[model samples]
Target chain A: MLELSRRRFLIGVGLSGLAVASPRLMAAGSSAGEQTFHSRPIPSTGESVPAIGMGTWITFNVGGDQYLIDERTRVLETFLERNGTVIDCSPMYGSAADVIGAGLDKLGAHDRIFAATKIWTSDGSETREQAATSERRWGIDRFDLLQVHNLLAWQEHLVTLKEMKAEGRVRYLGITTSHGRRHRELARIMETEPLDFVQLTYNVLDREAEERLLPLARERGIAVIVNRPFQGGSLFRRFQSEPLPSWAPEAGVGNWAEFFLKFIISHPAVTCAIPATTRVEHMQENMGAMYGQLPDTSQRRMMADYVRQL
Target chain B: MSGATWLSYSLQDFVMFGPEVFLRLFARINQDLWPWLLLWPLAGLVLPWFGRQAAELPRRLAMALAGLAWIGCGYLFLVRYYGPVNWPATRFGWAFVVQGLFLLILKGRALPGPMAWPVAVSWWLAVLLLPWLSVLEMPDLWAIALFGLAPGVTVAATVLLFAGQPSPLRWLLLMLPLVWSLFSAATYWALGTFWLMGFPVATLVLLVVALRFNPSPAQNPGSQSVHRGPGRQSP
Candidate 1:
């Protein structure tokens, strides 16, 4: 199987999105032996997304700069090379959706891509128009997920999203909040409303989500997409001077990137962790966390405590 | 940096460009235009007129100009210009366009009645503060604090100069710049440039003041000012 995957990776599907088989990804393992890519179900439809995904906050917001766009294309290629899906973007992130679309078009990787973006307006009319604009920007017919950014006018947009879902314009509907801004309001909405997913900030340092939001998601069967898994790059700045914990390889955690990511996805309710990156090597490192052995519950606590000590 | 050095580097290294880059970009956009010197001053003149008099024309004209400001920031600054250099400007361009339209149809007094001293102070501060930006010791190209174009200045002026009650339409118009001010504050901090933190702070302060001085419905229902947008005749 590994041999076949090597052939497929070398010459696969013309870089077609999902079908670009990457079984060879399992061959190159962390401290652990060979392992396959891990995926979690999107609780609503039971369809699985890769445990790792890409985010386009500041990283992909390079507007109209062709040089940067080409550089980002290299990053996307590396991501696909490592078998990534679920590229998350928002109109609020400047020209990210456009840049991502441009990169995917360059690579002919659209077929395998599972794209997601947000409807970020306060009114229903704007929401409808922005969603359409997002569709055009991403160069995709229907989004896998359409989130209400920061719950701005969520009440009005929710009605429109539901209708869009019914009309086959969007595959799933969810809402996002970040910076730990509105968890209580988010919780009430999760309990009262039916949604496929909820995107929020959750990391080793910011474990507040574990208190209610994560468990609520588990109970409500809502897949959680974790953002700011690096706390907007705060994690690296904090730990870059320190060496990786000597025993990190015990859980297949090779480096800080994998360590931070493994801790995020190890949570039972997490569907994926979308960490943005502009460099190909960083993309490779981020994707490496996907094949590793995730820490068990007690081990997760240990990882958290270890980081807290630092 | 060597290849290994680069690979090991973190996100701080990847953010690309410095604070001066952004400020210079804005300055380049404002290049050699003396006519624009009067833009904000004139808007300042029109902004407070929403409240002092009963004539709807001044308020309408201000709202129309406010629309132009939104579209100016959206199209002239954000899309046609800034977007080519920055990604946020593209989406923000859409925001400006939407806000400009919202203002075009907006109905209300700029203030419910006589301008509050706080509002007046805030407006004067927005204009007077321009020269003081020299104290910021920023690069000449980076000295952009014009209304309608910059984020925080836009927010302060929007709230301070708003005519009347917070209708759904008015709030819709206010939402983007309010959000943009916060984003701008954080971005400036990251870029290590002007603290620019005051935009969001001033916006909140003005909002609190406006809510307090707001007129009761009995005082100004704004029924006459609120009319359907163009081509839709009143019954």
Candidate 2:
């Protein structure tokens, strides 16, 4: 049976190659032994998303050059190897969604991906069109999660999204906002909308979300996706010439990036924190944030105090 | 006279180039003329309004020439200050390059928009203070008191200068240069340059000049206009 499964895998690889002619498939199959997978439960659905999701906002904005495509394919492979299924993209992040789609195709991870994207336009028609475009771009009949980006045109999109959810075209309907600018609005929507998930910026430095949005999400039974876990590179800057705080080890954070991210994910409300990275090493570091001992409430306060001191 | 004398002579030859040698070194260092390149428009727009007409021509000409010469000088200084393949410098250089490219593509200009001034200033401060603040246990006491104070001073000066009709945005904008200068000072320290001591003097001069030559014109009826004190329009 083991031999049979191995042969099936080989056949899957052969078919995948014949179907897509992707070198990524060849590499992925060849390096299966080297890959590691990690998983976390989706708060709403109980389905696991590989803890290390790919962020295509800034890194995947490299358009469609072959180099970028190859790098993206590797990134996808890395994520998949680590049991990561979430690929967060947005229509608002330049050409990232399109690039991610192409990378997904090249990596043959389209079906494997827990595909996530946003509808940013205001008009209902335009929102619908954008959703359709995302579907076409990703070459998928159904999306794992379709979010309203920054609450823009969300009211109009939510109705259609609900309809789509009922139609089984979208597995989840959600909303997201970055920058912590609209937490009050997000909380209101979480209360009003039947949201499965909600994404927003939350990190140690910016604890404003914790004041209300986090608890609200927990109460609403919405899975919380943390964005800008590194505070858009500000946290890293704070650690530039400084040694990692000694207490970081107590919380099981090895590096400053992981330290910041782990603090965010440690919150009970946080399902996942999608920290973007351009380097595979950084991807690995970010993924590590998902594992290990998380800071408790006391430790989180300690971390906050430490950051303030810096 | 002695073996030590011969070694010292060789070392001096390598390190301290004679006056003629220093001139050539400066020429090589100044090849790209980046400092001068950046200084030209600053002088052209700023100096004349300062009532320093005699200084203007010489300063402008010197800046233009320096801009031309510093390309090489700047390269040499960079090579000396940061060893070959310095990651941080390389990163900053690439950032500038990409920014220049982006500006070119978007606005058909190499320089950023005026709104970018605040951002630039903020970046400069961050660059200077971040490194120090990172390692220091008491950043407020040491780093903030020393370097961080500049932004406060600049902000206060802007508020005072703008007085009753001040736009908060303009006051915020002044903080940029202060922050940036702090960052540069920090960078110099990180690079182990004794010459960084001269930075405060340069910063003071720039601050005074910047305050002296206000961007707002007198005839402009904008509320944010910088009018000369008592009744006359501010230069």
Candidate 3:
């Protein structure tokens, strides 16, 4: 009986070990067979988070289609399997929150997920309603991060977010903007407001955020979640035809996803970059960015110049 | 800014409003009313053919169903379902109601005739079954178009009904459905729902038929002519 029990324990340990090893193996297989994920500290908490996170904009908006839901389930599975935590979504993104909820439910990913979504409506009452709706849709009691989407009624929503944070309904409060619309106002809010994180577009071509938002967030010790690292998949079209600089592999950039993502996360100010994707293969390539030596300042310059020339 | 560089967008992007916005509309409508709704489009196709005793009876019946199609879609789909996502749906719902009411009021004479049996049968088949077309060989009935929610059967029914009518007002009856067809097609295109391509294709066919079978209101006042519509080929 003792020998039998010992055998059962060994089997259990072996299976658990395989489960953990599989993800690292998958990461290594993709990243030229090495597994070491680099992380950056969230300045507010001084706690490190994996530099690469997931985004759910156009990618996870499959609505009620079971096939689409199943497809996205794999995406979230791949993300969490690779140690991805932050998942950014919005109420404006149609049925993405519901699908993400379903995916997390199916994978039993509730414990591991670092839930992040936005309130993207007008007025403070609507903000409260939308935030509750988002929580229900995501099947979570609370969120890790909640942002005022595009600063729409930002002041109104900020008050609610701060209260929620204070009440422990949410861990962090921040704001987001896109399409490069209202930077001056966002800058002022970040300076005057006590935000824990800020998400904004930053990539190879659209460096507009780098000018003001990134600098301000860093100065204020507000963790920056860089969005649109590939500029809404625009980088693929813009640079697909061009060959990667020969020296990219030296910095552990295996594909263009890494090339773009590495650039954003490598920035001293960028706490994390949430690159959105649907395909597991694409997610694997994205997680590859978290591994290896990120491009240094000169290499970042070389990468940008190559892109411009192309 | 599609106005500035419309050509710059790919055919896919030009059509897409995003899969979530596009598909969620179908899901909500489907969820609110599912198998019961399928019969609406089927009725739009099946009901009009029964009143063939009078030359104008079939035409009146067709017009009534067409109106119901518009009104049903306007209330259930445009106003109730789509109003939240698209602000313009409220106004479009009113327009559909007006169009439907016009059909109810203006059942005066035979427009021309119902589409030939073959064309009519094809409309029925496409409406009932097209959404079932799938690469995975499984159907999501939620995506299917019922009569009032969208135009799948109803548009075809109206086109067939007006194939026999030759009044100037047929253009008024035809106008909104055509625009809606184009809009639905663009949404389908964006969602990568290839089977719904028939919506836009049917719109194109109707355009050619409208130009050929009917006259510009300027070309002939009263514009009553002997020419038949696209469905004239059936007989």
| Most DockQ-accurate candidate | 3
DockQ of each: 0.12, 0.02, 0.13
Alpha-carbon shift of residue A2 in model 2 (angstroms): 30
For each candidate in turn, the TM-score is 0.60, 0.52, 0.73
Could you give candidate 1's per-residue lDDT for residues B2-28 as a string of tens digits?
385446545343343334435544555
Residue B193 accuracy (lDDT) in model 1 = 56
Clash count of each predicted structure: 6, 35, 7
* Model 2 misplacement above 4 A: A1-39, B1-235
Score residue A291 of candidate 3 by CA lDDT: 79
In Å, residue A108's CA in model 3 sits off its true spot by 1.5
Residues A1-310 of candidate 3: C-alpha lDDT, one tens digit per residue = 1122332344334434544875553232133334655667778776556788999877876555576689889989998777677789988776688889999899877656667899888777786688889989998877778999888788888988888877777777899976565778889999899999988888888888888888888899999988878877879978877788899887668889989998888788898899888789999999888877677788888888889888
| Residue-level lDDT for B161 in candidate 2 | 24
The residue pairs that clash in candidate 1, if any, are A17-A112, A18-A112, B109-B163, B110-B162, B110-B163, B111-B163
lDDT of 2 by residue, A1-310 (tens): 1122332344345435433753332231122221212244566676555444666665665432345556766766776665456778876565566667777777766656678899878777676678888888777765778999888878889999999888776778899987676677788899888999999988888889888989998888888888878876668877657777888777767788777876876687777778776667777777766555666788888888988898
Ranking by TM-score: 3, 1, 2
Which is the winner by DockQ between candidate 1 and candidate 2? Answer: 1
Off-target runs (Cα >4 Å) in candidate 3 are: A1-34, B1-53, B64-175, B185-198, B204-208, B211-235
Worst 10 residues of 2 chain A by lDDT: A28-37
Lowest lDDT block of 10, candidate 1 chain B:
B226-235
